[model samples]
Target: MEAKELEAEILRLVREMAPHLLDLLGVGPITAAQVLVSWSHPGRFRSEAAFASFAGVSPIPASSGLTNRHRINRSGYRQLNRALHTVTLIRTRLDPATKIYVARRMAEGKTSRDAQRCLKRTICRQIFKILEPPNRTRAASLTDHANQLDAI
Candidate 1:
């Protein structure tokens, strides 16, 4: 059908646009596109924490009477937050490393929801990295400069 073909084309474009993001463990075509659209320029976020805040996944404090806790965030980009939730579900169910992390966090007295929030923050960091432009290391830049001078 025409709709299926259009969907396939869109997916193809998204894959071509962000192969690195697509390569991530839990990033499907739709999730990658949502992330790319939400974070058109990754540099806009000062840090991964900032990006998580923008996505509405950053933990907010909810401490009460010496008991430390946090409540679910319900602000910021709801679509981006949904995308992150989708990633968390995929990783929690299928990714072994994430499974281990969830178990470890649960052992440390965190509820599954808390553990998932932690995972979403981590996923946001990873998404930021994938979207961020690679900066040349000092040594590499120096070597490139030396090579340019030699060529000159």
Candidate 2:
């Protein structure tokens, strides 16, 4: 297939895979697809923290006596990290929420790079939430239905 044709087909598949994620501000088709591919089965991750760890966004302990700092994690899915970075960069420029967050972090003595890292971490959490399966357990749904039958 021609490069342009292949690109178009991939974009189409990405849209079909996660239109809601694609609809999110700052998430392009590629970014949406990356998120979907990295988290094809969200149930594998028990929680957002697990997702963050999988993406290498969870903060690793770096405290040393009185001094404390977290180090940049150079592990996990690099493509996923890149996707989150892309979303963070776009949001820093366009999304009001991210702008406010970055500005607040900057005001609190964080450099733009640090603030962006923090924002990317935040994006990881959001991605996990978007990708994670609904919290309404099957038992809860059945219980609710049983209660409705009792009332009836």
Query: How does each model score on TM-score?
Result: 0.81, 0.79
lDDT of 2: 0.78
Pairs of residues at least 3 apart in sequence or in different chains that clash in candidate 2: none
- The 0-to-1 C-alpha lDDT of every candidate, in the order given, reads 0.83, 0.78
lDDT of 1 by residue, 7-118 (tens): 7876898878778888888788778888888987534666677888999988899999989988667787989999999999998889999999999989999988888888
What are the C-alpha RMSDs, in order, of all predicted structures?
Answer: 6.1, 6.3
Query: lDDT tens string, model 2, 122-148?
Result: 888777777665785446656776788
Model 2, residue 8: C-alpha shift (Å): 2.5
* RMSD (Cα, Å) of model 1: 6.1
* Model 1 whole-model lDDT (C-alpha atoms): 0.83
TM-score of 2: 0.79
After superposition, the stretches of candidate 2 with alpha carbons farther than 4 Å from their true spots are 136-152
